[model samples]
Target chain A: MTFGETLAEAWGPLREDAIQTDAYLEMLLAGATAGAAPTGDLPTVEGTALIDPALVGAARALRDALVRIHPSFRFEERLAGRLRAAVDGVALPRAAGDPIPFRSRPTDAAPGPIPGDVVAVGRLSVLAPSLPEPLDRLPRPVLIGGAIASGVSLAGVALVAWRRRPGRH
Target chain B: MPVFGRMRRGAPADRIAVYDTDRAAVRAAGRDPRQFEALYRKYLPQVYSFAFYELGNHHDAEDVTERTFLSALAALPRFEERGDGPSTFRVWLFRIARNAISNHRRSLARRREAPAELADALPAPLDPEHLAAERESVARAWAAVARLPADRRRALILRFVEEMSTAEIARVMERSEGAVRVLVHRALRTVARELGARREGDARQRR
Candidate 1:
């Protein structure tokens, strides 16, 4: 393999700390020897000469160049200031008697009834049974008239129910 | 083994401890907005640097950074902590920054304005007298990075510039760890080849 390909292959492992120097040297040596023809069980001379320090140096130099060119902008103070203002805006103090902000919760969990709705329901429940007490205190003539009216109303309701009842036809 | 198990095994114990501490801080921030200062202080530089590098200008970077933090603060209440790891917060925050950058880029494209060069994005104080000395190499490197495929360039920047680990990068990039590694590998190879070719051309020019 060419020096560039060899460096590329070794660069990731070396940079990521996955391989130590010994492993790198072994890999380089293997790459160097891969193309040599075997001469009948003879011990091949270790070709350490093919391992040029210049290739590794060049790779490291390139990495350094790239890193040096990484633009450093000092926007921390400005950004933090902006974030502080934004956070303050979001976390503003609630006014007295203000309702708590609505937060999303699980769909299966039902939300509690509103306070105003609860108060209206309570007032209705309390007033429903006492509604007839005022009518009971009417004068005798008025009470008699009310009874006659109630009877007429009951008769009207019975006629309507009978008309609408099933099998009436 | 679970995916997190592999990550945990690969990560140093101290790193995991720091991650846990950061996660706790995030949870505290969720409960009390005042506590969010800790997170904002901690990740401000990282997020800012990422935005600056990605967008290649401080103005846009600051704008995006502000939007990212504001959006994060607004959404903090809904941030659920499953006791997974600190990567959750990093990933979530970076996703916000990435989207902001994308929107900024789209707007710029609509306006027909090109992003400034990476070197031009440096702050005034960083523009040393010797900047001209290293301009050629820096330009070549920046150009190579710009020419890379989008995902590959992002992966490379997150890996080298942000000094993020593969697992963290995968979380931010929303890719598998294997895919991130392949991207970095290919990106590095491309960059090396480009630099080598440039050097050869320079040599020929000198001759």
Candidate 2:
């Protein structure tokens, strides 16, 4: 493969813990929006001691670019009207938004993965434990003690009931 | 409600509610195409934004967005909501959008890329300094993102723009969650490098 192709496919670890990068991103985006004011400090993520501040800012910038772009009112309403009419001849109120201007094209237009093309029943998984981890946390001794105590109590109650029989009295 | 409401703590519940609401809307829309308005309004911004970012202009975005809903309305009768994850309705809708975008891309392959003017966004910021800085940053980021390969760019847009979880993105991208992570990681690294390099270059030119 060419160097560009090789570089395109290659990736590095997010941190030693190998926690998912998208999770960190979710945290970063949330943090960036909450703060609003530029802190100049990189957002800290779990399982990583250091993060490149530039990366954080770039992610934020990309998000900002996306957030600002909106469809024109005419187009939105026109489409809404068309869709509304298409549906069982139902006419709906017109839709509207601020008139938008020309914007830059995205570098790539391929949808990557078509959701309909996916027919696999299960997601990719391998070497996962066959059995799930136990959800019960009580220690064996405590369980046994509780069971024995309950059994003894039941026996005593049975004995008392036997002694209180009407024929014996 | 806006496509993505205020990100509150109950996001998971919000997600489930979104799924529940989508299925309900899908059911209603299935019966009556007019009922699809709830869904169209809910997802119009998301679908349009996806196309706008992907296609890079209002014209193509509108086309793809329109095709997506039209196809969705036509296919509503067959859309059976299965239990896979949240936003099955959206996943279904985006699936349609993804296909429409692909077809549109092929048709326009020979055509020039979508025309874009980055200076003015929908609502211009009041402060000139803020506006200029935002435009520069947005331009830098968008250009760097545009440089990415198709899959990587799509992954980044879905992750950052759509704010989808890794699993959800995986579902949308038809890849494993692990693979989607790598795509986003590599894409982010690449975009960061470009952003940093461009910033330094601009500074040097100014000097």
Candidate 3:
């Protein structure tokens, strides 16, 4: 189909998606706020109000352009700038290591070497625990043993004091 | 698991900024959900657009977008701001999106559908002058994108459409940024060459 036709077909869905996104974000806002009470013990409330309609509108604009533009036009630099402003303190970085090349999946006919970015990120995920808490959940055995040792020493000191009391001697 | 005992030097300034911002947002999220709402509002667009471009379907994109935030919220309490200098959050979010899309593709063999009817009113024959004015290339460049291998298509979409940097792309692609750059560069050259060939064909027809 022609590019216009492709765009035309995609526009309705895209706009719908945008609206849906707004609603979803609203839901998230409501849910998050509902859980945090009015006078809760959270940090300073500075910079939280920045996610306004304006930011959403900018995001929509960027989304529309991405769908509309040709693949050859690189928009990373410009897009990063725009997103930086919209999110107000968020910066998205590109992969900076040596190129690993693109390798296709063996099962599909998609296309050399798998892109290193994917592998590196995966490696981090594998290495980094998804949970913020360390898997070092169980108490350190050595520390526990030390605590026991300290307790025994304290008990011995108490016994010696009782035995050396003047009246008992 | 390559632990750089210290943070890398010469990282993107924006990355540091993003980490700083997310650190506060994440901390707020842990303490108060409302505060986290602030972050949701802030990053939703970036997250949503990234999912949309990568997934290419309205329903799946939204699903993934919602899932990304929900998961982020659930996991927020433990999120540490490594101060890696860029919003690894966006990368983290996109990685979630990439996984969602990949899973769907694997399960359903997701194919690109024609753009919806809403695009019917769009003008055809992309104005070269308009594109040039924007420093944008010809519209035909997309056709080449359409013709790319699936993995390459994902890389191009992330690089061109989502406008993710090589490192961010690497995070999303689970590959090194260099790989992403190489893939993107080759993809662009391929698309340009494809367009050039098409133009030559048109000239021959005229002759």
Candidate 4:
């Protein structure tokens, strides 16, 4: 083999495994941080290194380019809150305007055997009192009035549907 | 573990930052979930950054970060310490993040929307034309890096952005150290070549 090929054989493998090179650079950076004269280690890398020093420098600097852009501070805090809630088993609303689901499990939710009562869809069953706490605040009369209106509206729709059945005029 | 003892010339080893174990934090968090704030604050940036780079969007990154932490916090009680080191917890957390990102990607595929490109923001604030030029070059460098294949991009980020050693990166990426090294070497070369080409193109335009 030519002398150049011989040198290639010697250095080819070293360039691939940069473990030592990285160790040296790390130690060099550490030494500089310690306020040593800060001169020795860099030159050693530059002198003996076959790979371009600019390439190595560029690789090191890439970290700065890929710098950790943080989540907004608000996002961080909100996520922390959610994680805390998760730990406590408090079911918080995931999105804005979404009703905070009851923490009660499916087996625990007893939807009464009444028409229009939501059969528990897994953990999502909107059990009457468990969900509509706001309705519980209104005066008893308004709730009664609203329930009567809903029942009337439902019966009217049902009566019209039966009268418009296929066999009826 | 090789300990870098405090350099006693006038100590070449000026003491750096504080050190704490993931194990201790995990154990504390497991006992009282409230203590988890320590681990949450510690790893939020890392997990968020990983998802951001991998998914190339802030919203998805936040989603993944939130999922990873929520899931981790729930699973904390069941977390058995496999070893006496700090990184076992870190590795586990990253694995969780990796899974979350994959699940997200699957859903994203169903939606059929292209993942958004990463925003090119300068790392540090700077002013003046020279500083602007420097930042632009840095942005271009990362853009080149971002265009690399996923494995290569991940390896580069783990090695550089996360400042993980090859061994650590291998465990995180679930690859051999030799594979990780090859990924970095090829990624660097691709980046160098792309940057060189861009420079040549700019020079031609100038002339």
DockQ of each: 0.06, 0.20, 0.02, 0.18
Looking at candidate 4, what is the lDDT of residue B120? 42
For model 4, residues B105-126, the per-residue Cα lDDT tens digits are 8888453222235544344545
> For candidate 4 chain B, which ten residues in a row score worst on lDDT?
B8-17
Share of reference contacts kept by candidate 2:
0.54
Q: Best-fitting candidate, measured by DockQ?
A: 2
| DockQ of candidate 1 against the true complex | 0.06
For model 2, residues B1-207, the per-residue Cα lDDT tens digits are: 111111223222222334455756665554445566788878888998888778877778888998898887776665654557654778778888889999999998474343244333335668878687866677667778777888998998887777777877887778887788878877888988988888899999999
Off by over 4 Å in 3: A1-169, B1-19, B81-87, B113-139
What shift in Å separates residue A134 of candidate 3 from its native position after superposition? 34
Q: For model 1, state the Cα shift of residue A132 in Å.
A: 66
Candidates 1 and 4 compared: the better one by DockQ is 4
Predictions in order: chain A TM-score: 0.20, 0.35, 0.19, 0.38
| TM-score, structure 4 vs. true | 0.65
Write model 3 residue lDDT over B1-207, tens digit each, in one string: 111121222232222344354655555444444344556656666666555555554556556655566555545444443544344666666666677667766666646552331133234547756654222222344345556676676776775465555566776677765455556545544554665676678789999
- Per-residue lDDT, model 3, residue B81, is 36
Residue pairs in collision within model 4:
B7-B11
Question: What is every candidate's alpha-carbon RMSD to the true fold?
Answer: 23.1, 26.3, 24.4, 13.4
